[model samples]
Target: MPDPTQPRKDTRGNILFFFGVLILLLLAYHLAKELEILYVSALFAVVLMPVLHRITSWSIRGYHPSRAIAIVLLLLAAALGLILFFTIGLPPVLNDLRGFMTDLPGRIPGAVDRLKHIPLADKLGVETIASRAENTAAALGSYIFTSLPDWLTHVFDILTTIFLCIYFMLEGEHAYEFFLSLFRPPARQRLDATLRKAELKMSKWLLGQGLLMLTLGVCSLTAFGILHVRYFVLLGVLMGLFNIIPVAGGVITIAMAAGVAAIDSWQKMFGVLIFYLIYVNLENAILTPRIMRSSVNLMGLTVLVALLLGTALGGIVGALVAVPTAALISVLLEEYAVQRPSQS
Candidate 1:
């Protein structure tokens, strides 16, 4: 008979469990690092699951769509959107851009002349800017030409991700089932429930983010209008679009706004900076936490670290999926790793 106080050992099972955990970590890291296109595609598929399910289930002319037909319809809708954008949106933007470029040379000297009157402009070598501008423009042009190959590579990766997303959307249910099969029946039930929770949270995030983007865009447009900022519409549009990427997005928009403002006057530039500073603080402190309430439960530090790690792993796509990925990881950790108080 075994002693009542003695603990039972399961050495072989423990060793196997350790190895399984190690392998999973290695596999996750490898996917995040090397095969980010597929990784992001999978994440995209998860996010689009609700939409796909709805579309597939909905009847048009008394006919429900097959998975392939649903996938094709989604792709076609996306293609239609691009076609509309090119036909409707691109011309006006191109015209404005062409007008801006035509006026740029004349505007530069005026800007430089105005800069000469500014405080400490002499000390800052403002006079040298005009001389350097031409060389700088040439260098920028050369850099853009040289970077074409890299740009094309990026485009290729985006196309591959899109293609993979289509496939994932079609067979995502099967893939999800296969994932569930990796565990015992009880474990599968738990995991299935956890993933559903994550999916709901991610869906909420999509809605919340869209609302935030719209609000920010409207605010940007109003602020720029009040300040009589040039290219206000384009800048506002950019602000809204970039705001999708979280922290890094704000920085890029701020820089662009500041540069555009500087072209007119330092006072306008300062005003733009002040507006952004106030807006960023307000959004971060108020809007973001409230809007992203579901994700806020993950803690600020975890989200920041996730963004950093994801960016390090796979650039923009990683960053795009970072918050959801972190949320999913948090769900797993809470379900398994975290110990809870037992009710008496």
Candidate 2:
């Protein structure tokens, strides 16, 4: 109690500063949560800049492209990509679907016969396997049908992300400079360098990812075609597209492919499985390491951790940008903590 006589130390300054910092942190976290779309747009813009830069450097019939012309050409390229996807990927899938529906009734009796052969199935007094399968199928159908609305929202979000990305690509320089202006000169310079490094790495991922997809697509296509598998083109393209999703995607697509193969015969199914087993091992041992070394340059554990953290922080969008974000954080830590370059 006697300490009160020693000039009551005004704690206002320290209290105010602490509260200010807390407010800033809370604001940053809230903004991150609310503006995920904007962040994702910025990420896509960075990844696509290399492609845009290359396109901008091209000439139209020996005439240099103006900014508008470059934009036109970029849009055209996007259109071409969509056109190819619909033409090459969608038709075979549709054909397979139609054929499956047409043949499903005829295939039912055979499926039932096979199920009836299951040992002890009758001894346990179980219902027909066909009935069990039908019930499972009905439940799955009900779930899917119920989720259509959510899927539509997801598709809308994707389209919006694309639109935002294009807008950012077209006119992001001003905004970028505005962001840089928030920091001091030295801090801004370091930030610019770190961001540039991140951009380059992300661009490399775009190229490497495309290469991996193409490799898988071609290999799967050729192998499935040789095996006379139904929906070979469809399955191949699906495998390629699914690779963007990492671990679970490949497994899901391969399982679907195997299911389709089983419709022909267990021999074809086993052959397909064997091929994928060898291919996955080869990819893990040889393909991914060689191709990604110059690109992402991340260890397997780093990637896994990045993905987990990103997913936790940003959901699907976070997972999408995880590797590049990790790369950016690594660059910052290196520049500041490891290198400690002399400040000018």
Candidate 3:
């Protein structure tokens, strides 16, 4: 009984709607790319805000907000300068990296040959093990040097990021307040609480994780130095930085260390493995739990979901921020859905 014209109009409307959505999505993507520096700066500012706040407060008795903010900006600038200095000075480090890579494959087989003579290798096979070692070394070399252009791009990106971070540190509070003022008083209060919770969680996570990484790097460098490992400083720093990756960080650290050690000698390779095993257990049992306690306590499933969603949205940066954002969302949802109902 429906008119044919009505159906035709409906189809047209649907097509228009679909196209509109597509256009909007494309626009959003473009805007995000254009403002990438701003977003990254904002993220860094948020992470470091608590440190700035504390320093500001301590120096200026009754929370002289402006002075506190200025101090934070200064600290941020100093940190960025240091990072830039090191990044520029990294050619020698790269040369050492190249040396390590070239030497690794030859060193690994000798170590594997030593392993073949071991009691455990008597039960397993020697040729099979040697083949596996070769394959692993090849894969590692490929992984290390496959994307030179991408590395250069990332380095350039870091300079822009530093500038953005300074800008955000300076203007963050005003921007936050402006956004917060958009809602009704009660809604604003709720929003403020949510923001505070997220900021606190993120700040604690950043500070604690930063300290943890520094400690881990120091420990790794010292241990590797004692073991006479090649490129110990470089490897230690890489491991420490990558340790932020969640769950798989420790495994990757051990794998990289082991691969490098395999190039040195069998005894060194064995020593690296043993060191990692002990280190990992110690980290898990002592350090991680302590560091992570103040941060958002996300479920494993939530973390995986966040990671996937983040990667889909923004690659590495997305993956880095996704877990914390998801945790904040969970907290907000719980506050509204469960807590509010109980209160009523």
Q: What's the lDDT for all of these models?
A: 0.78, 0.77, 0.75
Q: Write model 1 residue lDDT over 207-235, tens digit each, in one string.
A: 67778888888888789879988877777
- Which regions of candidate 1 are displaced past 4 Å? 1-34, 57-63, 92-138, 218-226, 274-290
Q: Which tens-of-lDDT digit does each residue in 1-344 have in candidate 3? A: 87879989999999999999999999888888646656666777888666666666664455565754665667678879779858863664677677776776667667666677678786787778777877786677777667766788877677888767766777778888999999999999998998788777776766676787777778888898899988887788777887665655667787888777766676897898898789878877888788876466767788788878877988878776776677678778876767564487
Identify the superior model by lDDT, candidate 1 or candidate 3. 1
Model number with the top lDDT = 1
| CA shift of 102, model 2, Å | 7.4
Q: List clashing residue pairs in candidate 1.
A: none
Residue pair clashes in candidate 2: none
Off by over 4 Å in 3: 1-24, 35-37, 58-92, 108-151, 154-156, 338-344
Across 33-95, the per-residue lDDT of candidate 2 in tens digits comes to: 447888788887887777777777887789776656666778798899989979876888778
What local lDDT does model 2 show for residue 112?
53
* lDDT sort, best first: 1, 2, 3
Residue 108, model 3, lDDT: 64
Report the Cα RMSD per candidate: 4.7, 5.3, 5.9
* Pairwise TM-score winner, candidates 1 and 3: 1
